[model samples]
Target: MRSDSMGRQLLPKRIALPIFASDALSSVAYAPDEILLTLALAGSLAALNSVWVGVAVAAVLAVVVISYRQTVHAYPSGGGDYEVVSTNLGKTWGLVVASALLVDYILTVAVSVSSGAAYITTALPSLAGHEAIIAVTLIVILATLNLRGTREAGGAFAIPTYLYMGAIALMVVVGVIEWVTGNLGAAPTAHYDLVATGGHEEGLVGLAGAFLLMRAFSSGCAALTGVEAISNGVPMLRRPKSRNAATTLALLGTIAATMMLSVLVLARQTGVKIVENPASQLTLNGQPAPADLQIAPAISQIASAVFGAGSVFFFIITAVTGLILVLAANTAFNGFPTLASVLSRDAFLPRQMYRRGDRLSYSNGIIVLSAAAIVLVLGFNAQVSRLIQLYVVGVFISFTLSQLGMIRHWNRILRTRQSGEQRGRVLRSRAVNVIGFMMTGLVLIIVFITKFAHGAWITLVMILVVFLIQQGIHRHYETIRSQLRVDDWTAKRTLPTRVRALILVSNFSRPSMRAVAVARASQPSAIELVSVVADETEERRIRSEWEESGIPIRLTLLSSPYRNVIQVILQYVRTRRKRSPSEMLVIYMPQFLVRHWWENALHNQMALRLRRALLGVPGVVITVVPWKLGEDAEVEGHQLVNDPFKRPTTIPSPSSDTLVGPETVEE
Candidate 1:
């Protein structure tokens, strides 16, 4: 089906919430695991500090959310950080943020799909070892949904997203009430001590122990992964796009922070324990548990403790949690393409990104994002724990840069509007962005220092690679623009003085006749037909067909011992140019148009190849003469012969010696 227009594609906040907020909501599924796992390395007391670490993350989330709200209001063009940075700082910094966001969006899909797959294995133990395949398949499914346009994909994902929000909120409420009433008991592994190793046996204390806390904080910051999606996707929203986007950002932040804190509290109260290595680090019944013992995720444990294991509530939570995690990738699918579109508009990406596909979605960008996520899935073997280390670096980089850009943006505006109500808002916005930048800058440092050895360096490398690629694309566009610009109007503009047409033909087909009529109707200086001779028998058969057609043009045969039609045409064109070096030579070839893609391979497309070779010849041109299948061949050819005054006229073509050469022209 054909897609709707851009106006029809605009999404209301209700639909946009799922398309953009799913990533932030789904982080609750695994953000708790990261915090608990990272802290569990520092013994039980530090692991018990999960809530405190979450509070720290949530505080930063508040600042960032407020900052982005201001961003959407101030700049509603949907360029997000790239636009902010480009307008405030410079285009170079804009590219840096773009590159970082590109990497972060790809990582969001990779990490989200991987975690979703892990939840699948958690729910179905028999499906173990197939996580990567399941994850890739999920990516393909998400890609398909997104390619169907923005609103369609948003509607498809809305139910599960709202379900996830309700489920998580209910789980948190039920979990808290159960613990308060002493109805929910400790988790299955609540009594198992987290045996510490590598100098963390004495619990968190002193500088050595403080670094572990920072590591956990940095890991917990994964909760903030998709916080900027709303800002990037402001253009896709309905009327009052900025206000709706800002409201969505605020709602995302509030829900996410609440869920994170709720999950953290429930985990703590139910004595849920998550560790990085279940094989060696975990113990049961005062001894090492079975190596194959399935450690339920923190959320799953909380769900189980709140509503008895295998209960309908627990299964519902588990099911929707997995769904939201997979749907989280949909956020990237929506945001990445929009951001890629902005980059394309600025000439930092391919022009393909600027066009919407049949469904009014950025289908090329979606395909490219899916391909990158699949590569990452296969590369990292679909291990969420492993892939997560490479997750937040790029996002925090974007966060820091985006905040800095917004601050600069406000300052620039404030200077322009010296004394007005607008200046007050600009100053307030600058304060928000300032706080956001400082906080995110600290997190970036923590992420780099704590996770660099783990895997964050790989993300930095990716950002650099993407940045360089964007720079390359920018340079290419700049070169093309420079070449197109008229430097010296009189000296630079070279006008063609004469025109001649050469029609290449294999047989007197309809395509050939159409080309002959067009060339004659245009009335070129002269006309000639070119054919490459592979063998006498084949050439004789063509000659017999041409004589029967009764066309006036003389046929010239070029030798092709190698049976290379392109080579024969190029040699003949070069020889003709040498003989008549004045006229602007036009090479026209007849082509049969096929209705099906597979029909292309079935046909021998010699004229197509001949066009490419003849393009390089100086003072020459190429034209396609397409003829439809099942059309009369002789009608147009005979029409051209019958036109009384359609005689080939002679024109005095000027030689290149009369043309001013660059070396002889005045600068």
Candidate 2:
């Protein structure tokens, strides 16, 4: 049982890197594309600015990564942005950030999986038009891997992540060397002339262009999506968790920024072109390119240019890039559950989210995140460009608020401080947080302004919806707590002076006889055999059997006009309770214990349903007198006595005559 309950396994650092860093790293695959696509609206000149935009994006990513490193060091509790914001800014801000992060994580999975499927379909033409199906399938598979356990999923991702890094690095090096040596040539689509869409063929410059530039920058900010995972996953790190996680964050940032910048530079150097509507906007030598010709992703185009078209190195780069994008969803798998566990601890989410599986991982969180991602993937048809618009808004929202919260946290800490050394440390940390706030706040404004119309509004709406739901959950828990509160007055109040035990009998069988004996032993004020009659023949047979058995207890029969036993019993109990409100009615129900799942089909569940309904009645108590079947009976007393019908030797049977009428019984 323990083994079955355990999570997949413990993840080593090698596996953890790909499992957590894939999102940040895989952004390199589409970061350049997003920049170029956004710039293409302004014609060739605007598109030419992709390299500078890439540089700016890399800079911001570096800052964010550094800021999060500090977060990991200070907190190291695996709460990430939600914890930081809530602890410092207050619960409202914390919940806001939590909602945003939740949506962002879901978008992460949707965007990554869809981008991966798109790349795969591009490489293998036979799989075209099946992008959504393929993307959903992959999501399901990844979810299963995660459900198995975190360590196992991480280990599964390790090789693909390293290969992806190695492939991209190789392409960057080879492309640069080839270009410098004059061996590199144009990409297959390099000569294609892109016709600007809409009326802005001249491309906007100055203020208009500046706005576009910010949009491009915001799009490129996709590179920073997974940087916070380290902060949320500090506990998953090895010894010296904070230090290791901080180091890992730095390494991830450096590598991701390098790859993103490399891809952008290479695309620019090789004259790679990407358009929104490739068939309509892209022309080859002033003629529209054939609709049948597929445009490869930005990274694949660079790989082919560097390694020569159709080369082994080109295929390797393409395969790993595609693989890494799919695995990038793993970062969300790592972050989402940990954050959910934090929210669960705070009562913002269901308590089950905090419980660990056999592997000591938040398995419930994994399932919830996966379900959310699947819905988004299906809703968006697995289109990366469409989904990318919703990507960074949530992340930056949290980033800005968390940094500001950190500032507040530092101020509060400083007020209680005494030592100069401690004060100096606090001041330095406060300085970093201040810088972080300004930087992230700027990026958040840019993201909202640039991406809101493109589809980000939907994401914001989702965040708000989630926020309301969380609030409702908190409210519900509070109401339940209030209702359950037991004060001294309530606790000291009387329970009951007497118990009226009713033995529910189906027939005058050994089981019913045993139930009567137990009920009598309880010494209730009133003891009676209550049986439900569904048909005349069965009722007469039961009555005759009772008389023949010579049981002294008076048998009371209730008619079930609709052939419903539970309803009849419920009505009878209600009538009794109304007559004597002070008396406690203990309904002893006879139940048979049987093995084999199919055995349940042979017996009616009326007793179970009846007990459930009886719970709502005041002054009513329901108890089950379980009659174990032959297979369920334990071997005892060296005889195969029908244990199901026979009373246990440990409990002495009561005399039937003493329990025949109403008489007050001691509590």
- Of the candidates shown, which would achieve the greatest lDDT relative to the real structure? 1
What tens-digit string does per-residue lDDT give for candidate 1 at 1-667?
3544788888998898888989998998998899999888877888888999999999999999999898898889988888888888898888888999999999999999998998988899899999999999999999998888788888899999999999988988887788788898778778787878688876678776788889889988999989888888998999889999999998899999999999999899999988766656777677876677778888889888888888999899898999999999999998899999999998999999999898888999999999999999999999999999999998898899999888877777776837777778677778888899999999999999999999989998999999999999989999999988997998756665566677887777667777776676665666666777677686677778766766566666666767877766777788878987877788888778777788999977766767777778887888886766654554344644334224435423223332221111011
Worst lDDT 10-window in candidate 1: 658-667
TM-score for each predicted model, relative to the true structure: 0.88, 0.89
List candidate 2 segments past 4 Å from native: 1-15, 206-208, 418-425, 489-495, 509-514, 521-523, 534-542, 592-595, 599-604, 627-667
- Candidate 2 lDDT, tens digit per residue, 1-667? 2555333344445666777799999999998899988888777777888999988888888778877888888888889888898888889999999999999999999999999999899778899989999998998898888877777777788888888888888888888999899888788778887676775566765677788889999999999899988888888877677888888888899999888888888898898988877778788677787877777888888877887878898888888888888999999988999899989888899999988876566789888988899899889888888999999999999989988988887899899946999999889888888887898899999998988999989999999999999999999888898977877787558778666778888886655655666675576766677888877786778778876766556677887756877778778888888888888889898776676778989988777778788888877888887766673335122232333234456544344533353221111
Clashes of each: 0, 6
Give candidate 1 misplaced runs (Cα > 4 Å).
1-5, 206-208, 420-425, 486-495, 506-518, 534-555, 575-582, 592-603, 627-629, 633-638, 641-667
Q: All candidates' lDDT scores?
A: 0.84, 0.82
Superposition error at 61 for model 1 (Å):
0.5
Task: Output the lDDT of residue 215, model 1.
Answer: 89
- After TM-score superposition, the amount by which residue 614's alpha carbon in candidate 1 deviates from its true location, in angstroms, is 2.7
